[model samples]
Target: MGSPAANQCYYPNGRSASTDFPCDPGVDDSPCCGGGLGSTCLTNKLCSGPDGNIVRGSCTSQAWSSSACPLYCLSANTGGTDLISCSNVTRSDTSYCCDHNAFCCDSGVGRFDVVPSKPQTWATWSAAASQFVVVNPLSTAAASSSPSSTLASKTSNAPFLTTTPPGNDTTSGTPQPSQPAQGLTAGAQAGIGVGAAVGALLIAAVVFLLWKMKKNKKLLEGKQRTENTWPAVYPEPPKMELVGATPLRQELDGSYVPTELPAVTDRAELYGHRV
Candidate 1:
């Protein structure tokens, strides 16, 4: 290579800075600005000049923008800084920002967790499985106060000690909302959720397809049944024809002939076939 100084001198944005004393002087330094926005801050733990000079620059904080990563880091999963990696996220101060328990995901930390608190009960149960009664802490006192009355109060001013509200277990320290779910960090959990949704969609699609197929089959069957049960149609009949003839009086000197046979007006009658 010609020189490391030549590459680091020119920034991608057309800005140039030349310094005899490189940030690491004798060491070969890589080019900056290629990483894009917030890229300059990512080079080392502490901030420095464009050419990696230690004394020539001052530290200034810049908020990471959209161009910094593929996805925006959500508020819940974010640390002091907006950026997070799969392994760990380091802050500007060099302190470790995120805990290693869950994967730092694009949206945030994915949680598929199990509740930690154990439930407490004062009720007694029989092995017979038929019955159980909540042990009333005031049952004995009630019997003594008014022997005749079975449902007597413990005393005039004492409140009955029964069930406590959900989450108000006086026995332990305020139940710490179970520290962000134990295992299968953000990445694994997100994958599982996406997979489940896709599976459900596929199942629904299959069911709809099957229903459509059955409907079409029923329609075809109904059409065939109608054709089989229909009656046959008949064609039109032939029309009747008429015939006419002159009378026999014109043939015998215009006189009415009694001996001659009358004019045969009908063909069927001449043949003696008239019905």
Candidate 2:
């Protein structure tokens, strides 16, 4: 195919312009087909009355008369509509080209158009609705595409798309240096994991120690105690044996009898005082 005229048509990818995609038998159409910069696009749009009530259908740039405020067209390229064709669009008037949930940052200079506290970003829509809205006073890509060459912005110049990177002030056009988001860094995450593991081990050790201590306590409670202090009990002593007893003998035939023995008397002294 030959090159596309400057403002004629663009291919699915923004790099180059072409009329039709190369033929593919079974693959059918690519997801990147259509929804080009100048293609006819359509989707559900967010419209509201001055009372903040939702209104059906889309509003043209002229609908938002606050020319003092930054106004740019956003294309909601949601769903597979990007794969559909925009060949039917000969002009872009009320249409817009907004990426899914994309935002067009703006500043204000007109009545009731105080600099917005925050950006007016695009919201996602289930239906297909996309067009190039011009917010600046200068002619934008949408200006040539819109029907009557009319702009909604009250200003004389604005960028087609005003997307600012993080850490950069939009109005000042200066890059600021600051700490990044508070999300944990890779090393910090690793440290947290290690700390958690150590904490788990410590908790397990403490639990085991507590269990052992409880067991020891139960054992001590169940043990018996022994003490030596006690009252002593003794049996009565037997009567003193007789100083002198008569001699007796027992026969072997199961009968007890006195033996043929005589009783002896005690001698009192060597002088034969008693017999």
Candidate 3:
């Protein structure tokens, strides 16, 4: 008998909230592949803290939109689509995704087709979804390949594929090639990258301008403070010419008119001191 804990839904070893473990959020409450009955993922939130410990909480529709849980929650329209070619879409849950009675389910990184009635178990699902391949959208090689080919190549490399064997073709008895899940196009990825870069640059520029303005304001305030703290000194007024001769001038009719000379005070006396 498999250990009941083995079937329980928890983050796989080394997997955490930081890791990408894409799943169809619609069937979170259903029993995952390899999980025994009663071992449904309903016990814990699919996305949690860094430790990946299973905690009791609702992984609600709001959680999906907010990116608190970054699973590729598909809507009801994806029901009949093949698992390999299904769209890796993140949509708000209207009648699916995180609900108990999910209409559609993709067990792992949008690769495994799971009947919502019989979803992949916790052990297999977490392990498969956690093997995330980081693809550089800006690389020329990636751009050269078709979107389907690029996606197929990445999904084919999952380490868990060996662990959880794929369903074999009944007639050929050969393992079928893993189909590629449709994701964002190279152009879309590039646009997102460019937008992010532009946003960061704008934020940095705003911060720099604010800092510069604050510095200038402080400097101006300091200058004003200095001006207020000190008093100004000016040159003394010009002195009167006390030692010069009194006026004695000739009138227009040639008569000499002498003006009485007033007593002149010494500089020291003028200044209220005896000379």
Candidate 4:
């Protein structure tokens, strides 16, 4: 009842391979049927269970309505390899069977038949089926060697290479050390010295001019004070007399004195009267 599809065998991890094993009718035709009229069958691909039990199994798209076909264990089917006759399961009107594939599950539990309609049974069966999905050797080798090959390719064409010390950053674009600062030139140093000497000379000239002006001002003030004072005066000394000089009091009395003819003048007057 199901639509035809490829019986590509796959592991639980989505890995698959094409096998070189022979496909015999009935014994190795389909997972459920023993080579029907239009059945799709899968060849045996080895697997290992989680508990280390080895299982030989194949997948099929025969007489099943599910999109993904079921896988059956070749070693666990007690009544020949045809699962339909061995499990005695009947198909419902929906084109699904209660016993589709006898899956190799957990180690102690061995093979289990899955029911599509029952959620609980499907969950248990899927969990057990995942453990036995084999990983291919070729794929494992490629995965292991990928990093080394990439590293080799990067180093092969490099212009140069540098080894990073332990505890240092191994990334590209490391920073370099800076150069030392340059010193001043001889010409610049000489210019600074000359400028300092010129400044000192200018300062000394200004100080000398100020000192001369102050000294001249003090001399002029002293001359002005001397001109403003009055001349000193003293009393005349006693007059000095020349040798043989007359006394001032005597000279002044001589002009006003009467003559002393005294006796002669009285006698003459008496005689004239007698004549």
Candidate 5:
């Protein structure tokens, strides 16, 4: 009756029931055979299924297809609740994608794939991350903000005009006993003048004594010369006797001879005449 019941079975819904039936054999036909979609069967082809359906394959070549296919497939098949394009997502963690590594991300699961940590190019990682902060770097309007004690300590320890010692007070007071002052004294100066006067007086006394000794020596030498030049005594003459004690005599040969001598007559006029 219906083309004598073509040599194939059919479902009650009039769909093909045999593998050898003349089917359309669309781009992704594996899901139709088993009444379930298979992703591997739709390689390089647009999905003709309903919205929010899983794609039947991976991409084979570059194409200008709608982004909805990949989004829907990721949501339905992988249970991604907040599916978004790879370019639209913002990565906040300190990570980056390198090479062809797939950026595996989850909506709120805190699971993500990233490249390994390497040496940072910037001087510090904190400096690089500070750019994303919402406030300005110079902002001082936030609550609980105060000066850092480290900076305050450094400034307090610094040398300033207020903490320096005064220069005028250094030489103000009297010196200690061990350190004597310089210059001359009144008593020592007077002693020197008195010594000079005493020396002059001693020189004058020595000169006077020497002069008196020289005068006495000259007087003694003159007296000795006068006493030697003149005699004090005179020599006496021989005495003569008037009366003859013996007759004068002449001696011949070696014998003495007596001689007659004249006599004086004034004895009493020679006893008046000659006796």
Candidate 6:
């Protein structure tokens, strides 16, 4: 029989008798009690022989308190018998056990069993999940449910989940219209119209400039001709002058004019004289 105080069986030599001894509710099994030679005490049913004094259960040594050890063990086995045994209990009940490897009822969407295959940045995971939910109605519904269910669904479906492209709205997949071709056509037509108008204006300006130049050249030629045609010589008007003085001789000749004495010399001289 075991000691009533320690709840552990011992041999007649006052040493531990069994290697599979159960732990006391509040007593630590490490640093096993001393006894005679060849006698041994085991810790948490995991150690054996005289040297098996260290606590070696599923939990670490620091968690060996009566309050913590059993809870740790129960939680480690939560997906199996432990959780099934505590299934009827509420989450707030101390008897309820939770699994660290599987999605627990209280764990959130990205925690516990939902952890990613490859390590993910917070932004990457959130962006991917958000896009998936936007495109998939079922995923969206699942995500809106309890955190544990959401996490479980996400983990199970991660390989098949698809995400919307960045900058695209997942709710609507409508594409935007392209504008380049239409814009280019309009711009080309406008440029051609403007170029034609400018060419016409330039031609008109050149014609006007040429007309003004020709008119000025003709006027200059007319002025040069008028200057070159001017006369070099001009005739003067006649003037009056006095004759010989025969006034005294003319009074005698008038009285003698009745006689024809001078007719002889005057005929030939007056008719043939060329002097």
**Best candidate per lDDT, number?**
3
The parts of candidate 3 lying over 4 Å away from their true place are 1-184, 229-236, 249-275
Residue-level lDDT of model 6, residues 1-275, one tens digit each, is 22334434332123343322322212332212223333232211221224433212221122222221222222222111122112222222112222232332322211111111221111101222221011223233344444432233322221111121122221222222111101123345668899999999999999999999999999999999988897666667678665756544433444443555564564344457677
Report how far residue 89 has shifted in candidate 4, in Å. Answer: 99
Model 1's lDDT to the true fold? 0.30
Kindly list the per-residue Cα lDDT of model 2 for residues 1-275, writing each as its tens digit.
Answer: 21212123222122332322211111211111122233221111222223332222211111222221122221221112111111123121222222222221111110011111111212221123332232221333324333333334333322222221232222232122222213333455678999999999999999999999999987776653222233355668887976669767676787677787558877686665665
lDDT of each: 0.30, 0.28, 0.31, 0.30, 0.27, 0.30
- Lowest lDDT 10-mer window, candidate 3? 156-165
| Residue 22, candidate 5: C-alpha displacement in angstroms | 99
Residue 134, model 6: Cα distance from true site in angstroms: 32
Best first by TM-score, ranked = 2, 1, 3, 6, 4, 5
The residue ranges of model 6 lying beyond 4 angstroms of the native Cα positions read 1-179, 182-188, 232-275
Decoy 5 TM-score against native: 0.21
Candidate 3 lands at a TM-score of 0.24
Candidate 4's residue-wise lDDT over 167-230, tens digit each? 2221123222112112233454567899999999999999999999999999999888886685
Per-residue lDDT over 147-244 for candidate 3, one digit per residue giving the tens place of the 0 to 100 score: 43222223221111111113321112223434323345445677899999999999999999999999999999999999988878777989888665
Instruction: Give a tens-digit lDDT track for model 5, residues 18-126.
Output: 4321111211111111122321112111122224332222211112021111211211221112222222233332111211223322222222221111111111012
**Model 6 compared with the native: what TM-score?**
0.22
| All candidates: CA RMSD (Å) | 29.9, 20.1, 23.8, 35.6, 46.4, 30.8
The true-versus-predicted C-alpha distance at residue 24 of model 6, in Å, is: 75
Task: List where candidate 2 sits over 4 angstroms from the true fold.
Answer: 1-15, 19-201, 217-249, 252-275
Report the Cα lDDT for candidate 5: 0.27
Question: Which residue ranges in model 5 land beyond 4 Å of their true spot?
Answer: 1-183, 235-275
In order of appearance, the predictions have TM-scores of 0.25, 0.25, 0.24, 0.22, 0.21, 0.22
